[model samples]
Target: MSTVAIFLMIAGVFFFTTATIGLLRFPDCYTRMHAAGKGDTLGALLLLLGLALYNLNDGFSLAALLVSLKILSIAVFIFVANPTASHAIAKAAIDAGVRPWTRKGGKP
Candidate 1:
């Protein structure tokens, strides 16, 4: 169980690092938002799940189970909220006439 929890945390960190890189490297808001939305949502879920599992490592109690459930509920909230927020941001940018990046020669 500890091993699994450790793996989950590590994987979550990896996704977070990739997302940071994408934010730094992507040429446009749309692509950067894509990276942030997808990577952050998954990373947060994995990290929260790992934390919940780690909390249970001491042994399962009603209290521990409830705590884990709460953690998972937060993850569920992030899963729903992040994408919706990203979409709204993208829509606002489009409405404001922010265009996507294009090739220098005006090609796809």
Candidate 2:
């Protein structure tokens, strides 16, 4: 159980780091939004899962249950909001005629 918790934490950190790098390096709004939105949702979920598991280590208790519930609520909120925001951004960009990035020498 402890091993699993540790793995989740490590994985969460790795995902978050990748997300940050992608946000910084990706060209154009769509690709950057993809990196940030998806990565953030997954990273947050993994981190919250790890936390929930750690909290459960001491056996089921009221406080532990509350903590788990709070984490779950946060994860659910992220799940709902992240995609919605991403879609809105994409739509707005398209309406504004924002161009996507392409390979050098590629035709637009």
What are the candidates' C-alpha RMSDs? 0.9, 1.3
lDDT of 1 by residue, 1-108 (tens): 999999999999999999999999999999999999999999999999999999999999999999999999999999999999999999999999998899797954
Best by the TM-score measure: 1
Shift of residue 63 alpha carbon in model 2, Å: 2.3
* C-alpha TM-score for every candidate: 0.97, 0.90
Give the alpha-carbon lDDT of every model: 0.96, 0.88
After aligning candidate 1 to the native by TM-score, how far in Å is the CA of 92 from where it should be? 0.5
Where model 1 places Cα greater than 4 Å from the true spot, the runs are none
Itemize residue pairs with steric clashes in candidate 1.
Answer: none
Encode model 2's per-residue lDDT on 18-83: one tens digit a residue: 999999999889899999988888888888888878778888899888998898888788889988
Per-residue lDDT value at 97 in model 2? 99
lDDT of 2: 0.88
